[model samples]
Target: MTVKMIAVDMDGTFLNSQQDYDREKFSQLYQVMKQQGVRFVIASGNQYYQLKSFFPEIEGELSFVAENGAYVVSEGEEIFTGEIDPEIIQEVLTILAKFKQGHTILCGKNSAYVNEDEPDSFIEHGQKYYHRLKKVPNLFDVKDDTLFKFALSFPVEQVPEVLVQLHEALGDKVIPVSSGHGDIDLIIPGIHKAHGLMKLQELWGIKNHEVAAFGDSGNDLEMLKHAGYSYVMSNGQPRVKVAAKEIILSNDENGVLLKIEELLGN
Candidate 1:
């Protein structure tokens, strides 16, 4: 199938376990894609700043669907921005405080906010994913910022119960999407990577049939199903694998770049 735009998920689909990719190889592939008029988009639940840092050479030539789907940017321009009500954000902060969710981060358009009391481990990890993070005395006091989503971490075993509690407490305000590993993103309802892709499609006048996507895990399910050509990494969860049109090599193998090379070669 002919593809006009290609979107990829970051965590487990493009970056490997250590969170690095073959930049030189990707640069070569991107040159080919640009020449063929194929748009490149980074679809990730991670912060837009963090994701953009990965593509320094061609950052302006691409698009970003970050904070799940709360923020969408194309070619250095903001296409869409979804935010939660201030009252609802306060409620979420209360609930998380009750749970002692020290790993929770209040993501905003300008920067991500984390508790100053959190462990150093959390701070270190947060720094890697959120380039512009602030240590706040209290999340409730965070004002004058457009909040996007909340990023939380939990033990793999506790995720299910935590999700149920979040659902019952938050009701329809938030949607919890697993971004793989122990990370869970609490995003605003009706906002997701697919919504970001839809925005891009409208701007570029492209159809789902001409779009290709790659992802792996809960948050990626919608984007995968939305694209005509969807691929899940072999290292992805079994359930996620079924949602894609085909399975590819693990991220550590640079499966995404390999597949793109094959597609371009054809």
Candidate 2:
């Protein structure tokens, strides 16, 4: 099958368990894909700044479906954005307050806001995914910023129940999706990785059938289905595997790069 654009998730689908990839091989592969007019898109739940750091060599050339599709950046420009209403953000924060546990981050276009009272370890962990993090006295007082999503981290065992409660409380106002490791992101309704991909398709005039997507978690379900060629990493969640059209090796094995090589007959 012919592929024009490729969208990949970061954590488990592209990066290995160590959160790193085969840079040498990927750098080479990127050059080849560029020459062939193939677009490489990083679709992740991470912030745009964090995603951009991974592709310094291909910065402007790469596309980003960041914040789980709440934001899209192409050619170094923000082409589309889906921000949550201020009132809705307040409601979500209120529900989170009831839990009184887990780390909460308010995702914004400029920076991510976190509670100043969080433990240093938790703040450091948040830094890993959110590059532009700011400690705030109160999340409710965060103003004059374009809020994208709310990301929370709870104990792994508490994830299921927390997700259910948030869904029931928030209803149609937000889309709560897990990005594995007990992390949940509250996205704007009707906006997700798939929606971001569709926006890119329109701008590039590329058809869905010409897209190849790789992902490994619940948040990636819609994206995998949207592509003509969908691959679930061997290490991906069980439900993600069921939704994908095919399966490939784990991230550490360079599954995504290998598949692309095979497709390009390299």
Candidate 3:
């Protein structure tokens, strides 16, 4: 099938175990795709700054669907943004306060805010994902920023329980999805990677059938389903493998690039 755009999830689907890739090969592949008018979109549950850091050479050339689709950036500008209502944010935080088992990060357009009460280890771990992180006295007290989502980290075993409680407490007003690595993201209802991708498709006049997507986790589910050519990495979660149209090699083997190369007839 003819592909006009490609969206890839970062952690397990694109980046290898070391969180790096073949720079030279990717650069060459990007150049060819650009010349062929194929858009490359980095669709991740990561922050925009974190995602941008990976593609310095092509910073303004690609699109970013960050925060599990709460924010969308293109050409160095925010084209679309989905934020949780303040009331809902407060309610969610209240529910989280009861559990007291995870570290909570208030994701905003400007920065990610962590409560001062969190352990030092949690802050350090959060810094690995959130580039512009701020330690605040209280998350709910932080204002004047467009809050997109709540990123929470808990014990891997507790993820299932957390998701269930979140859904029960928040009802259909919020969306809770696991992003792997013992993390769960709470976004506004109906907002996700696929929603963010649809915005880009509308902006570019592209269609689902003209797009190719790769992903490896729960957060990448909607995105995979939105594309006609969906690829689940060999190392992806079992659910993702079942949802995808095809399965490719693991990220450690540079499977994403290999598939793209084959698509380009390299």
- Candidate order by lDDT, highest to lowest? 2, 3, 1
Model 1, CA-based lDDT: 0.89
Compose the digit string of candidate 3's lDDT tens values, residues 13-102.
Answer: 899999899899999998889888899999999999999999988889789999999999998989898878898888888888887788
lDDT of 1 at 231: 95
Look at candidate 2 and give me any clashing residue pairs. Answer: none
RMSD of each: 1.2, 0.9, 1.0
Residue pairs in collision within model 1? none
Worst 10 residues of 3 by lDDT: 166-175
Which of 1 and 2 is ahead in TM-score?
2
Residue pairs with colliding backbones in model 3 are none
How many backbone clashes does every candidate have? 0, 0, 0
lDDT of 3: 0.91
Candidate 2, 59-160: lDDT as tens digits:
888899999998899989998988788998898888778887678999999999999999998899999999999999999999989998999999999988
Q: Would you list the C-alpha lDDT of every candidate in the order shown?
A: 0.89, 0.92, 0.91
Off by over 4 Å in 1: none
Best by lDDT: 2
